[model samples]
Target: MDDTDQIVLSVDGLQVLIDVLTADGYRVIGPTVREKAIVYDDVASVADLPRGWTDEQDGGRYRLVRRDDSALFGFAVGASSWKQFLHRPVVKLWRARRSKNSWQVVPEVPPVERLAFIGVRACELEAIKLQDQVLLEGEHPDSHYQARRDNVFVVAVNCAVAGGTCFCVSMSTGPKAESGYDLALTEISDGEEGTVFVAEAGSGRGRSLLAKLPHRPASAADRQSAKAVSERTAASMGREMRSDDLHELLHRNLDHPHWDAVAQRCLTCGNCTMVCPTCFCTTVEDASDLTGKEASRTRRWDSCFTIDFSYLHGGSVRTSGGARYRQWLTHKLATWFDQFGTSGCVGCGRCITWCPVGIDITAEVEAIRDSEAD
Candidate 1:
């Protein structure tokens, strides 16, 4: 963002922003300490933020650590993303009642929820955009996802520190918030500065809302400091994967032996897909009460790792664990561009951290590339 439009917010001002957003009738959700992880949930005030807390993440590992400074939003992403709130793991479509040997369909009419999400990362923002392409923009768009996606407010945060599993820099997705946000915050803390957030407005609504907060025009020095934050983070990314012609690379390696290697390590537990920010596969489930008087339809998230996900008339496709693993990684880094005009991955690296066996997506692709060279 240009220095002319930049501004600064103190800790108290940050709390005011949250209060103002709530007063504007938005359910302000943000990162907080939950279950020893920084998860997104209802954040009523700045006090609810995970100050002085950061996370240590690696393949098949995650631990919460304390930072010397009380910098809110200092940590990287946890297991949860904003997808759960927007895409929703479970949705009730409708209910029905049987009256006089006839069934009457009952329509679900729930009040639309207006949500304001804070601490959304740049790659996570891209994940949301990818979901919009799949669920909101196509000819046969998903009405349920669209309904929840509308009228939402986004407050993006630029990374001041990189996670042990992060590779967003390799994907060219972020260390900074480029777009798809209302307000973007960069927390700059030092002994001289104590702690203050440099805020940038990305939309008209953001600018209007920012003008109401207790803030001062950000100086050029502050802008430089904020730029330094992303630079340091980008330089220190924990992992990387080459993206040039990646689609073709995976496509040609269908019979690659490395698939079997990964399959041996993969438990087909679907943990990666479950924690993924952009995986949108879902299955519809219908159930009836024992009384046979009421019935309901619901949509729940499904994964390619499940055997039943590819069930056909007689049997399941991709029967072997290798085939299932290949399908997932291939679709994420290769065929997703064919389907959505963008890579299915934003390189957040949750797949590696949350995998029980520490399956790294970058290493898998590199192995395929190395095999091609050999």
Candidate 2:
């Protein structure tokens, strides 16, 4: 967060930084063009990144576009979030095997994934913090999340380009990373001077890594240029959400007509919950071999939109699409505050851009507000 340790790195130096992290036994995870979309995957070098590409995103739409400038972190968030790596979509809990007519239960060995997350956005960082609160700070902590989170290196990116659905500024989360990063970089494209990055060390590990990379001390001009990038991104935010009094607003609007309207367009495909970085709901599945000698239990991500998600002995609590949609929205904007002292929505807009029917959360909330005001 401090500028005292700020340094400058050329595009080549950025590659060196990646090599250093990889040499230090970290799986270098970053953004790359895959299937025509910039997605997070294993990066072998700097060339693997989507350098000259950005994305055009809106409700029910996402398309990759080439940028005039070859900026690596120019695009907004993709459909894939950090959740797929940290809170795995599916995990085997334990396996039961029959041995000598007695079942032997054996726990699955935890994976040793020392990940180095590169190009992490500010809202993504905040979402990670929120997950930490739920998965680590809670009474019954998730061992899988705890194990995967240990010793993970975070390299955050200061946004220079805002996507069409980005509302992190309105949510008070991004365009700039304030905390939760080992190293933060702001990529500045200079016409003749070429592209350079203003890097700052946010942790001791970051400071150590920066020391190894080839870089010069950032001048006052460098710092100002970096600050300008954040300013530009903040002003370019594509959407705005009224974060004030959302808990009480949604709390009182439980029976509002907006839910039914949204439900009409909702497919309940669970795309939003899957892309949500903070959604932690999951369900377990038990499997057995044909011989019935071996059995296993696996945990996979689940969504509130599914009727079975609220299944009880007699029937599912939320049978209608309206009820399920209300549960998803209200819990995100209302009960999340009661449960965890913070809004569940990070305003990253993944839910908006990836929805099959283009159901926008901000618009849905605004509809209720407008109706109540009328």
Candidate 3:
């Protein structure tokens, strides 16, 4: 059989797989209930997963609820994406200390952790690839990001339930994982068999790990069930965007009245950027000791919504909320194609769900198209 062939793993065997990964010195990180929400955290067993629980998300709303059965990956994504581990919110770049006659410099090197990420969604996988293009394929590739990314393993989850704000189906980035995973799983629950994972190996490492697990060759029925899960999610999506000529549409509507309308409700809190899986903007900060003997440079996540983000020689370029909002939206939906050859958004819908004022990006795009039609 081909190495990429599908297999079926019982729910109990899933724990054994986790045990094997942890035994191999991989820090397994997956979804867990935290602060009344399902967020990624350290996992050693099935108990760490959001079992028998799911989430309800909408524009500016999120709540955890009990599921009918114990399905490990029944819920859609939460505010936290895997980018937190790979890109990091804050990192020290280097340090310098004053010497007797000259300055002594010490470069800060980030420690690489052997990480195995569980429950990675399809859209998030695409986001990871986008970040690789941004941080690993650029003129000045980020050694720090590359080190962590290289040491990481991905266990992707195909969605069975689409969040109220999710639009990954529209973006062609989710509801099903196509590639970029060591192993991909589609959770299936049956009255007789209870819950089982239909798994597929995407890499040589995945096949090697599966060989060690208690998994059997998947049957035709299991494959059909897995396909049904993705179909249900695609049909149940609460939001969607029309992507036809989307880049050109946004490029032409730079001064659209809709931007001003949304800007009035926007708080510019940077929550959207914080939750977005693909937003990669960052700022560098330098700090010195009170004695001015020691100093360090640090890189921290930044957002375009901030006034200082667009600061130039004279002052902040995007001083108005409308201008900043325009810059962010245009860059994400339009100019990002020019810069990266793909849209900055993966349609995970974190931006819409976490927006303070329930601002839906798909709705905004539709409004622009409607106005142009009129």
Candidate 4:
């Protein structure tokens, strides 16, 4: 919001800029050409990006296909989420080393990595904000998550093309970035002459990076084009959420019979929650050495779909699949606002597209709403 000034960089030039950031002691992470989807990974240059690559996705299906356009990052997210970087899949808390007669326990602190995450979507940015509340701002803070999050710089990218599964528009979390990013970029590939990116700085660090890049003064036309691109993405969303007041709708429909019907189709495979960028449930484990002299503790991601997630002193609270699924959906769309002051969903549609049975959250919500209407 400081100024409209921006530097235009060609696709190749953008890669060079990342190299420069790396040379200057910043670890650069961006979307790269993976086996089939555009995945976030370490990249040293532009060639590391998924150039001329796109994806075709449907319920429980996704495939990488070639595109005629020479556009990098023309696809949606891969299986990996920002959660892998911020909240690690697995972490060791302590290690047990043996002395002559007794064992000594050593605490393992998380290594803070100065990371620059490039090409983060607006929805993912919001997801990070949600996690920030849980991991950093919560009552009991996670020292490990705090270290990684504090040392990180975010480079957000506006979606140029909406995936078949994307519904960020209805969620109101994306199509364009609002905040929580150091830099935001709108990739312009539909121009008459060449490719260019319109960059905006969200912080002083971002402004400094822009100052070092080879860029030109942005014109009013560039700003207009960026706006148009975001508008198109909003219009092209594959799914739509009808409940403008999502919280009220979710609470009202809790007892709706539709929950039972959907539970039949749901495998409870936990794929939806696992791939979700904002789902932050976790469980801890303890291990001991063979001699029983040393013990270590580890933490890993957990899902509500799992029966043990709700387990407490007596027994599992959510015993049935329907109950657990309902808990997850209600918490994500309804109660999450009260808990985190934001909707748990980014509307990336990953849950719908990645579910083993292709269970569409939007369709389910509509069904419940329609039943109530009748």
lDDT by candidate, in order shown: 0.92, 0.92, 0.90, 0.84
Clashing pairs in model 3? Answer: none
Q: What's model 2's TM-score?
A: 0.98
What's the distance in Å from true for residue 210, model 4? 0.6
Question: Worst 10-residue stretch by lDDT in candidate 4?
Answer: 2-11
lDDT per residue for candidate 3 within 191-261, as digits (tens), equals 46888999988999998998899988888988988989999999999899977688999889888889889
The runs of at least 3 residues in candidate 4 whose Cα sits more than 4 Å from the true structure, single-residue gaps closed, are 96-105, 190-193
Q: Which has the better TM-score: candidate 1, or candidate 3?
A: 3
Candidate closer to the true structure by lDDT (higher is better), 2 or 4: 2
lDDT of 2 by residue, 25-118 (tens): 9999999999988799999898999989999999999999999988888899999999899999999999999998799999997788899999
How large an RMSD does model 3 have?
A: 1.3
Using all chains and alpha carbons, the TM-scores for the candidates as numbered come to: 0.97, 0.98, 0.98, 0.94
Q: What would the per-residue lDDT of candidate 4 be over residues 1-374, giving only the tens digit for each residue?
A: 85465656666667767877788777899988666677889988878878778777677888889988877767777767888998999989899877897778898989978888988999899889889888889788998898899888888889888888888888888879989898888888747747788888898988888787877777888888888989998888877786577899889888888888989998989999999999999999999878877889999998999988889998999988888889889889998888877788888888987898999888888888888789
Clashes of 1: 0
**Candidate closer to the true structure by TM-score (higher is better), 1 or 4:** 1
Instruction: Give me the runs in candidate 1 sitting further than 4 Å from their true place.
Output: 99-102, 191-193
Model 3 scores a TM of 0.98
Error of 3 at 313 (Å): 2.7
Clashes of each: 0, 0, 0, 0
